[model samples]
Target: MRAQPTAKSARCTACRIPSRRVHGFYWRSLGDVACFGRPILLLIRIRRFRCTIPECPRRTFAETLPGVARLPARQTDRLRSVHRAIGLALSGNPGARHAATLGVPISRSTLLHRVCSSDADPIPPVRVLSVDDWAWLKGSSYGTILCDLERRRVIDLLPDRSADLWRRG
Candidate 1:
């Protein structure tokens, strides 16, 4: 379906000035979630607002749809979220296969990219740590493994397995 912003005035992205005069409009094609077993594509008519401030660097700015989707994104917010969840649960090829089966029809690489690009919750600081020696080779070399006990995840791996190196870290 086709759509456009109905607001008469939009704020300039650079100067934050509200403008009623529309400089121009452009078309944006976005991928949307499937409906009734069919994929949906939305054609949005985006409006451009002129930045009247002489000091402002931007001459014109496109209206932003914060709730719909972020800039430079081809898919809608909810659709991308669905794809990201699938990617996180299945990962790589398995995720892609599952997405296709669900009628999302996204590639494995795209799914992975979506998952990686999305912001993750910030991890809290490590209060307790667990250190141990991990063998690089079965009997040839070894390394030090540092883990965050609170988070239950590996924090870092030291190249040398020497006691002094681990103590200094």
Candidate 2:
């Protein structure tokens, strides 16, 4: 079955103006979850609207549907969300294995990429800091590793083990 956009008008993203003039229509293929134990594909019909504003730089724009897949996205929104969760929980190789076992086929690299692309908030300001020194070449070069004790994450790695290096880092 084919689906069409519900909205009659779309706002131009570039100029921020509501446009009702239809430029054309196109078919977008999307991947969906299993239906009756079989994978499903959706062919959605989308409308393109011409910008009404005279000074608007954008000539046309496509309609967007809520709960559907984003533009240029192969899988559905729900599937992407599930993949993102698995990626965050298991990460990379483990995540791929888990997804395959759950009947959601995904590569290790894709899982890793999804996790890396997700929003990551910056670590909060840490009051407590720790420093440690380690050998780079055993009996030769050495380096210092700085950590935030409150956050429990590495902050920086300095090339020298000197006290001056610790103070600077």
Candidate 3:
């Protein structure tokens, strides 16, 4: 299906100035919800508005449907949600297999990337420390492991397992 947006003016993202002049329009085909077990496509006629500010470097900007999809995105917002869920539920190969069965054709690498690309909470500084060592090549190279007793996780790994190395760290 095809549809033209009704928004005549849009605010400039760079300078925050409202633009009313219509430079041109472009057709963007987006993947929408499935219809009767088939993927439905939505073609939106997006308008490019000329920036009113003279100092702004951007000459024109395209209108956006905030809740629908992000700029330069091919899939719908809901489809991204589905991808995230599938990506998190199962790792790469298994996720891709399940996604294909569910009618969403996504690559195994893409699923793995999606799951690992999310912003993670920062780990705070550790107070109590636990030091240990393990051989790397077992008779060749050795490494030191520093763990936070409170957090119960490895804080850092040193190249050489020694008292001097542990003291320096």
Candidate 4:
């Protein structure tokens, strides 16, 4: 099923700008919401709008739904949630296996890529921190990761796991 284009113009949640010029519309397949022990696929028609203000930094902005973001191929917010959960709960193969049950089709390598590609950085004034090392290519290459001990999330990844690197960081 597809959603119909309504008279309503969705406003940008980030910048609070109302846009009327829709670039295009596309259907996104979202996760199933449970109903009577059955899975229901949510077919959401999301709009890609042209930014009304030329002065705005972004030329085009997608209208965000309640839980989804723009430009991602996956339509389900559950996928992202599962990815994040897997990333935090377990590392390597185990995490990917766990994520599979949550309807996210990610491999171990994909999980690692997601972790390394993450742009989130912990804000400072962090009291306790954890430093650990992971082999990127099994003995050939290694990287050190810094984490916020309190938050239990990775802060940064360094190329080498060395005392000099830690000292410089």
TM-score, one value per model: 0.68, 0.60, 0.61, 0.46
Give the lowest summed-lDDT range of ten residues in model 3: 113-122
Which portions of model 3 miss their true places by more than 4 Å?
119-169
Residue-level lDDT of model 2, residues 65-123, one tens digit each, is 66677667887876777778899999888898887777667899977876686433346
- Name the candidate, 1 or 4, with the larger lDDT value: 1
In order, the Cα lDDT scores of the candidates are 0.86, 0.78, 0.79, 0.66
Tell me the lDDT of candidate 1.
0.86
24-59: candidate 4 lDDT, tens digit per residue: 877777653334534446677778788777677776
* Candidate maximizing lDDT: 1
Over the stretch 73-144, how does candidate 1's per-residue lDDT look in tens digits? 888888998998998999989999888777787998988998898453346789998988888897889898
Tell me the alpha-carbon RMSD of every candidate: 5.6, 6.8, 7.3, 8.4
TM-score attained by model 1: 0.68
Better model by TM-score: candidate 1 vs candidate 3: 1
Better of 2 and 4 by lDDT: 2
* Clash count (model 1, backbone only): 0
Clashing pairs in 2: none
lDDT of 1 at 121: 32
Q: On a 0 to 100 scale, what is the lDDT of residue 6 in model 3?
A: 83
Q: RMSD, model 3, all Cα superposed? A: 7.3
